[model samples]
Every structure is written in C-alpha cells, then in structure tokens.
Target: MRAGVTLRSYASRYWEIYNKISGDNERVVASTFRMGLPEDSELRESLTKKPSEGMWQLMGRIEEYKRLEDDRLQSKSKAPMMNRPRQTGFPFRPRGGLTIQKPTAQMGEVNVTFEEPVHRILDWIKHEPYFRWPNKMGGDPSRRNQNLYCIYHQDKGHTIEQCQVLKDHLGQLVKVGHLKDFVLDPGDRVVG
Candidate 1:
C-alpha cells in the first residue's frame, strides 16, 4: 500500500479511540490526520504484526496519532481559565496555636519552620467537593471524630441559638482583627 493509504487507515483507527475518550468532533480527527507526522520505517518494523509492511506501517502511524491527540487534549484541558471563582471550604486554622521550630539544615544554616499540621482536608475537598462534615457520632462508620462537643457544635447540628452564637462570635472575631471579613455575596449561592 502507498504511504498515503497506510496513513489514512491508521488515522481512522486512532480517531476511533480518540472519539471514545474525548467525544471530540469527527472533523477534528480528520484535521488531525492531515496534520500528523509521517511514520518512521525502522520504528514501524519494531511493531511488526504480520500481513504486510503496509499493516505494520499503519500500526506505527496509529500509535503516533494517539500520542499527538492525547497531548493536544491534555494541553487544551490544562490551559488556565481567567477569573474563575475561588472554591471555599474549611481553612487550616491552627487549633492549639502555631509554633516555629527551626531545624539545622547545613552548618550554621537554619531551615524555615512551618507549624501547620498537614491535614488531608484540601485534598479531600478537591477530590470530593460534595463531602459534608464527617458524622461525629461514634455509630457512623465514616465518622472521623467521636467527641460529643465536636458533634453538637458542628454547623450541621447548629440550632437557631447555636447559629446566633456562631454569627455573633464570628462578628466579634472580625471586629477584634482575629479573623478577616469573608462575607458571602448573594452571587456566591449555588443554584441546583
């Protein structure tokens, strides 16, 4: 088979995989085939499948096409979007207060101290956005905390009185410069 014929056949197969993975337009596949690099003969032989040289060449071309398409999709997906809303979640506030402990790195060198405990809260929020506060009840298998105070004081269990207490406390904290003002705007509400 001619090089053009072999390339076309390989590209068609590659497009099938790409379409399955990305749900991209078929026109994009056709354009990709037209723009893809030519197959190398030595590399083609290394992937020998039998039948004819044309078949081997097609296989090599398909592999190359898959690589290119995958890269293109990845690059496109990773491009940063402007003015994206920041996600809100529980922040890592040091409960017991933070301490700085300098470590000896080299002779006469001090390592910078970071007192924050490494909690998996940020990672958890990223992976599971809908994750509610873990149940504080001991009976709940997924509960992370068993302390009754933590359970009763949680936002989930907040009664009207508790909510008022919380609101007042937060206001006081803001007034005393202990916490920054992070008032929620109406636009922050999520419509389901």
Candidate 2:
C-alpha cells in the first residue's frame, strides 16, 4: 500500500478505528498503522498507554540483537587482513590469513588458482557485483558477493556451470594444472 493519505484513508475506512495520538488526523494514522503493519508485529502486540514508547522499545531491542550478532560473527570469522599488509598490484594477494600461494610453473607455463578473495574493482559494483553472493553461508561466504567472471568467455551473467558453449572449461584448466584451487563440479566435466 502507498504511504501518506491514500493508505491512511484506506486503513481508517476498513479497520473502523482511529489513531490515539494524532487527535487531528487520528483516523488516518491509526488506519494506516493497522493496515500497513504486519499481523505478527511485536510493536502491535506491545501497544500500551503510549504507542510510540512501545514502538521505540521494540526498535531498541532489534538494534541490540543485530549488534550482538554482528559482534559474534566478527569475532568468529574476522577478516584475513587484520594483521597482514595490503595486497600488491602486480601479484594478487592470498586470502583466509594463509601464506601466499605461488603458481607451480611447469616448463614454459604457469599454473595458478582462479579463486582469489574479492576486491572492489569499481564503486557501484560493490553493492551489486557481476557475480552474486552464494545462496548458502559458510566460512568464506563473502566470496559470494564477489564478481564472478567466467574465465572461459569472460561473461558476467552465466557461470561456467550453466554455460553450455564453454562446458568442461574448468576441467580442462584443471587437467592442465591451472586454477588448481577452483572447486570442480563433477557434472560439469566433459565425458568422452
């Protein structure tokens, strides 16, 4: 429902109730609160002598819980770079607070892991990356928010998992001892 007068009018007419605080536009505010708010809202349940007080209390509780959760996660997974030096430009940095992993070069070729911790390449992309965050959460779930570039075609929309044209590209890289760190899905491998 739309905010302001439209929603207020709808709520007052439907609920047959008026807002206690706003004597001037009591009907409008009260109606809106009833219609707009969810059925299982804690604020609604905690309505007291002062409706605003109850709402404020509920907000404070929510903030407290959110902050607590943030603290817990921060202590648990803590970012890898807390004590480490910043990453250099020429060579990408290793993530997870682990030692830097160098590619195992064979003859004239260099093999490296495709997986690297996320970096903010652009300002706008931080909020919305080319690769979406993973649906499941874990120790390294932040990688989900990183931009996933399909190395095979350098495309943004589809990962190699769904790219029929570039099927088994990851396996081929693995076969050649390249991107040894990339987790290979068995279904994506090409079968002769």
Candidate 3:
C-alpha cells in the first residue's frame, strides 16, 4: 500500500501554494490541487500562486484574523432589548373570506416581432422602412444618425434609449388594457 499525503489549508485568499526548491524555478504549467476545504470553494478558484510549505501556516493565521473581525462586527451591531408594560386583548376573526379575482380568458397576450430601423409615420399601422446601421470598422459617421428623433415625443435631446415619459405611457396602457404580461413589459421599454 502507498503512504497517504497530508495537506494543510491556508487562508481563503491564499488557497493554493507552490512548493519550490532553494535554487529551482517554478514550472510553466503548474497543476493546482484542492485546498481540502469543501466550504471555501470560491476562494480556492482564485489566488493561484507558486507552491510553498509556509503558505498553509499563514492561511491558519489569516482565517483566525477573519473570524475575529467577523465576531467584532457582529458584537458592534447588536440591538439592545427594552422593557415595557404589556396589555392583552381578545383576537377578532372574520366569519367568511372574500377574495376578488379576474377572469383568465379575458387576459390576452400578443407577441410582435419587428426588424430594426422600421419607422412608423402619422398612420400607426403602416410604417415606412427607414433604417441606417453603421459598420463596426469605422465606415462612415454621416450615416450614423440620419434621423435621431424620438418616435413618441419627436425630440432631439435623446433617442428611445432615454425616453422615460414614453415608457411610463406604455406601462399605463398595459395596466389599463387587457394586454398580456409579455406585451405589457417589452424587452426594451419602447412604445413601439
């Protein structure tokens, strides 16, 4: 039978330690072993370092310090107890239960899929295809924002990105109407 190797755990931060000879250099591809502590899996993943024997002893000190710090914080945050005169009264209960519920069939849900840069003019249903997408490799800045106007308010201060008023109006529509949960809250808070 082969003899077993005993490994000691250092602090959570310094979970991995590398053992090196006096004059020998660390290897390029180092195999990291588990710190043998199942609880500290998070700290084990990080702080991968050169191997050493003293790191484990240092870990014990660090864990001890952390424990002390935690204790001090808990002690400082303790709430004081207060003494007060108490009076007792008979508890009252309702004879019957009443709960209002909406009809499930009335609630309708609609999913709308639209391509980018589809601009809707005065008429809500019919929209003219007006879109300009800039090339990632710095093609042309002129085509960047040909029409930078809010569809709801028609302002230049901000695009649909910073349109809070429009978003709130859409939310109000969802709340008042029988629109489905998905339609009420779109992926992006845009009126369209």
Which candidate leads in lDDT? 1
List model 2 lDDT by residue over 1-192, tens digit each.
343322222322222222123244433443445445445544334432234334334334334433444355447756421321221111111121212221222223533233322121111122222222222223453544233322223223333233433323333444655444453244553447
Least accurate 10 contiguous residues by lDDT in model 2: 87-96
lDDT of 1 by residue, 1-192 (tens): 245433323443343344245443444443444344355543244334332234334344555644544455447768432322222111111122222221111112322111221121112121222222332323443353221111113322222122334334334433444332243333553347
Tens-place lDDT per residue, model 3, 1-192, is 012211211221122122111222222211233344233433333333423344333344334444544455446756321221111110111122212121112124543322221121111211112211111223354654433433334333333333445334333444565223424234654553
Using all chains and alpha carbons, the TM-scores for the candidates as numbered come to 0.17, 0.18, 0.21
Top model number, TM-score:
3
Candidate 1, residue 137: Cα displacement in angstroms equals: 43
The better-scoring model by lDDT among 2 and 3 is 2
Cα deviation of 16, candidate 3, in Å = 54
Where in model 1 is the C-alpha error above 4 Å? 1-52, 79-192
Error of 3 at 126 (Å): 11
lDDT of 3 at 164: 47
In order of listing, the candidates' clash counts read 0, 2, 8
